[model samples]
Target: MRWSLTVLAVMVTTGCTGLELLVYPSDVLRIPEDTLHNLTLSLTFNTTQAFDAALNRSGSVLVVRVVPDEEWKLKIVNTPVQFTAQEVTEAACKTVMVSGYYWGHTRLSFYLTVNHVDDQFLPGVLLRDDVVVVVDRSAKLLDSFFIMGVTLFLICNTVNMGCQLDLKLIWQVLRKPVGPVCGFLSQFAFMPGVGEAPVTGCLHTTSLTISMFQFSYLIGWLIFEDPLQRLGLFTLGCCPGGILSNFITLLFSGDLNLSVTMTFISTLSAMGMMPLWMYTLGTSLTSENNYMKVPFANLAISLVSLTVPTGIGMFIKYKRPRWAEISNRLIKPITVLILVLFGAIGAYSSYKAFLMMNGAMLLAGLIITVAGYAFGAIMSKLCCLKRDKIIAISIETAFQNAGVCFIVLKLSLPTPERYPIMGSKDGHQASSVKFMKNVTFGPIGLRTSLWG
Candidate 1:
């Protein structure tokens, strides 16, 4: 029995390795023993056409398509590559490679055209860009394992706490008219600001900024802007407070019981609110044929993932307070270790995206963090809450469930066919990491607000 228990513990700790191997098979790196020489293709495009109105009479955008021989199994190398008119103009031509799996002679074809903003095609524009690529099937299985393991460990740590849900205390707080009112305003009304606003009906500067950001994204989509990117930003704004709110509350020596209770309330409330917010704000963003598919299963899973561990923690607190205290003490160091590991893995894997990330991304992260903290404080102050409760509310309002938002992005946004076209997967992953890093700024803001 002892041996079995030990085995279970080890399996639980190392499950991510198994998951990685299953998801990213070694066959990705293995070439068939009987394979012949590798295959490559070269292609060209002309960028000078962008300057010629007579040639580009149809559109400003360039489209390139490659057609390989039906007998050959071909794959594009370094897919989702970005190219600009300036790069093409400077180089005069661009080349891409395609790798063939089978040992046989194959033929290749190219179709190039220019597209206008209205999706009209322009003919007679020759782009002088040619490239061929050989596909490298080498997969980064270790990186995958590391990222998944770190995420699991972080979630486990966040949930592995004693739930001190004081029913009587929660009831007393809610029974007061101010408590319910404050909770409603914090979740629904208080938000970050872009600029100034009249302080009336919860529409302060911070809240106005947040609202404008969300609304502008929706409006942008309506006006045929980058719809997928705008959808991602809108979803981030819609997420409710995260489980990390409880940890921040504890860190600031605020009311642990109240924090836990509010987290529970908000999470349960999100089940309804999330879908409602998405539907209300995103109706114009989707077509009737391609309506946004909400990941109800993932939402349910997130709720279960949070509640089950919290219930266990509550049991520990009630039955084993000393053990709970020890577990809590251990979490701090473990969290730091996990963060360091995450940073290394993220930096290594996403170095290119990090370089490509612009000032707009940093500004977005900063605004999300600052606005959450500032508006939350304003709301709490308006409610006339005491210092401790005010601190709890502020933290709760500022820290959103970025994990849940990421999941939604992964599951819902950008269909499989459009993944490569939009580079949605990589874009979201980078943005999610940036958003999480920026979220750390909230606790600092909270601490500063408390001191002030």
Candidate 2:
């Protein structure tokens, strides 16, 4: 019981350690007058602009009035209306127009100056140039509800789910999975929208991502009695299918060692292969693919991100089995919790973004995205590999590198917050972004299902 308690505490603290909300000043007001200055004015707007400032409107004043969370008005001039604040925030920003105009200073510019609302010197902790404050009363409240509700749901689900996944039993049953699942969602939750999510945006994503990705498949060999530890070509290609595809092959005539070996190879092959695969895939997709530069540097970063730490983890797990057990019991679940939180937050943000965009278009996009997976699956099977090989290759083919795509989007839409955002279905549009979670792709081996 005490060990469980310790594990639980570690999970909560570690999972949330990286979360924060950034507030900033508008472009007009963002320029800090002096390093010693404290008061800063920020702007948030929600209307279309006749002319564009993002293009280069030299003489523009962005005006924002400071009111209590529920009562505030911010005016941005010359930017697209998309709740694009001039400030930077990983979390969502919330804004509403108490009153404004289609033309004039309110529409032409956003201007703000700092003043103490409460006599006391405004604490720097609350204000930073690096991060921007996306304060909206409506967004705050609604987001509060969103956050509180999801958090409670997650907590309940995690506990209940954890209880069912008998660690010992699963460890015994799982034949040393090469890693975790990788598919469109498994592979491309953060990947570009060439395909659709396996599930809807409204999902307990982490729960699904973890269970489905990690242990859904297994790989065993005729040559080796054990279902894992193969350093071969098949494993190179298939280990990514995780346990799901791995075991699915056992039903058919499958070579477990090849898949395992292939997995080891595939995971490492990112050095040369990821670039080659992505480039070839992108070029085939469309002219836009050619236009889109694959950030090989970032891809390299991601490969290192997963490989190094996990290798260390495995080493420790092997060298000190007890410590490995302790760490796995703690780190793996915590990692899952963090990922679940990431998925839920991303889902909420995506949902909020969906609400803001044309509903029909986004839905169409979703359908097309999901359909991409089906297309990939069909293409994989048609290639004429064995059934087991099909599973490995299918996973390899279906999984898109989402983390890379999102990074590209962020790079492209660096200052998108400057646009005027439409009113959102969830009261505060920006609030949904508060937990703009990071996408960590690659294989993640975490426990799922308590003891049903």
TM-score of 1: 0.56
Candidate 2 residue-wise lDDT, 1-452, digit = tens: 00000000000111111112212323223211111212222222221331232124323322233322222222332222122223311123534322221100111122132212212323222211221223211233445565565445444433322322333433432354322223333232222222212333433243234323221111112121211111011112221222223222333334433333333344444445434433432222222311324455765554454334444545554566666556434533553564466456645543433223333323323332344345445544555444554454444433333444444433322121443222233222232222111111112111110100
lDDT of each: 0.46, 0.30
Query: What number of backbone clashes does candidate 2 have, counting pairs of residues 3 or more apart or in separate chains?
Result: 66
- Candidate 2 residue-wise lDDT at 219: 19
**What C-alpha lDDT, on a 0 to 100 scale, does residue 232 get in candidate 2?**
15
Error of 1 at 317 (Å): 1.8
- lDDT string for model 1 (1-452, tens) is 00000000000111211110001111112233123322222222222333343233322344445454442345545332223433333333344444444322223334444334223444423222121112212335665676568557746665564444445676677677464456545664444112222334442333444455233243223322344444554555556665667766766766666666666676677777667655654443343333455566655665676677777777776788777778777765665565566656656653433433445544554555566666667767887877777777777766666656555654544322232212334344223323332222222222221111
Q: Pick the candidate with the highest lDDT.
A: 1
Q: Looking at model 2, report the run of 10 residues with the lowest lDDT sum.
A: 1-10
User: TM-score for all predictions?
Assistant: 0.56, 0.33
Q: Highest TM-score, which number?
A: 1
